[model samples]
Target: MASQYSDGTLPSGNIGRDFYIPGLTPVGGEDEGTAFDMHARQTRFNFSSNTTLSNGKALKATIELDFMATPNGDERVSNSYSPRMRIATIEYDGWLFGQTWSTFQDVSVLPETLDFIGATDGTIFVRQAMVRYSAGGLSVALENPETTVTPFGGGGRIVADDNGVPDLVLRYTLKQDWGHISAATLIRQLAYDDGNAIDSTETAAALSVSAKVNLGRNDVRMMFNTGAGMGRYLGINAANGAVLNASGELESIDSSGGLIAYRHLWSEQWRSTLSYSWFSADNDTALTGMGVTESTRSVRVNAIYSPSKELSFGVEYAHAQRDVENGLEGDMDRLQFSAKYAF
Candidate 1:
């Protein structure tokens, strides 16, 4: 009756199983027969550069190194460096220091899929360390507030503490010919006394727009975004583990939204993109006690094939659900396949 009845707890004993626990085992021990250890070789190397400074001013950079592969010895380094920087100061109407993307919306309607680090609601924002400006197109940003804190119930249990707030931004963009429109406003600073006197001040506002259309061969991109108490293009709070998003209220989870994507480039080696997103957590006492809930929905589909140009292949599927008024339910579904080569 034990075809594999340990550490693989899934029929509802509550999710577990990624076995292999030596070193005196005791975190839900299993594998009494022993003999299975080999799988932890991760490799990564990346370099990026873009320089054009003869007065047009532009500089971009990315460097990453991660390693771990061993047979008997040698080649065992965890990190040489992981750096990302984008230095910009160009003229034609836009320029100014560090971090990128946040013009508001219309990023080519986004979807190349293969999940190159994104695309499931796809509105991730980063590159902080602020200072930004863009003319004619209208853009403004001043940001700094990357915070973190982690520790979870152990010994005395019932310990849940998390706080996040670091923001100051204002953005505006409008580009026509059928795509691009943006709006953003934010001011955040929260965490007071008990958490160590950080004071308090919060305000959030957001509106994102996107557009692209070409019916002849099928190419369509559409987008919409909204924020109520603000902060949540990519939110985090995993039941209080806090990677970011600390009850500034994420606009009270009144997250409004929209996304529709369609891409077809059938001849350039085939292509496909189908997307969907809808989040309307219309406020429920603002996620009362931080237990979380207002409303949630997510969907994704991606397909890719690029016969040449750095090679490619892909497949993806995702599903999400969140509904709580105290009934409680959080869900996720994923399926993925990928292949790629680039230099």
Candidate 2:
């Protein structure tokens, strides 16, 4: 179970608990007070199998689940949530299928923290269905695509599921005795249709790099990503993929995000990490107006203790801030504690 006590309230998705988010952390309101909550939604389990094929090749399958997306029941009642799929995959002969982490993200670059996503603001955190092929250190795949857009004056948001093209990704990794490094690219066509005269598509591309370097018992992890129309692929969808121009045509948005973290071992069973993350969107005020989010950032520190490989406890403190194009800003401070047992 995990618990958090914050100086400010969180946005919806209490399922996410108190995990830090860039643009959504604070919306700049005076309704601030002590906010506290606890949940076990991040608890998860997995099932896997490996078998030999008729040709003597190995085939493996995995299905994992957690209740992060289950509708929270009334705490006054059952307070039980159902399971949801996190990853389900099949791999054989250098080929993989099903839903998993996006090729654009390096799972190893994720930092260790009590929050659901440690490096929340500047990580390429995405998971979706795809077909992938791997050879040596190179892998490529085409993934699911959806576009989020803001109207001409930024009244609200429009999630356009009218993409005519899938997102394409290519990644390569380098591993050595010290650590590992990875770089990837994503290409997609952002499309939208209002069934009127507003049907169009815009092509956009992005680049991401991540690495982990080991220094004896201490280590460092980092990631950087930038592109046009990055959209939901970066910083937990902190920015939109595109925006509708006055002509009702699609125009890709420009954005960048990155993170860095350092971990130190203090004793056999104790460790600590310090990290910082940020996300920025180059929104055209003429089109998006002053109400949309412009940038967000956060800093966090955590300490963890593990008496054994399967049992661990952690505590983290995080400070996050959000800014809008119109100069409105809000910041929050949060402290969290968690305990976990893994089998």
lDDT of 2 by residue, 1-343 (tens): 2223233455344543546667666565666745667778789999999999999999999999997774665667576778889999999999999999999999988988888897788899999999999999999998999999989989888999998878999999999999999999999999999898899899999999999999999999999999999899999888899999999888899999999999999999999999999999999989987898899888999999999978999988888878899887877777889999999
Alpha-carbon RMSD to native, per candidate:
21.0, 1.9
- Give the residue spans of candidate 1 off by over 4 A: 1-118, 121-169, 181-187, 195-217, 220-232, 235-262, 265-271, 274-343
For TM-score, the strongest prediction is 2
Candidate 1: tens digits of C-alpha lDDT, residues 300-333: 6777787898887777665555554444544444
User: Model 2, poorest ten-residue lDDT window?
Assistant: 1-10
Candidate 2 lDDT score at position 268: 91
Question: Model 2: how far is 16 from its true place, Å?
Answer: 5.6
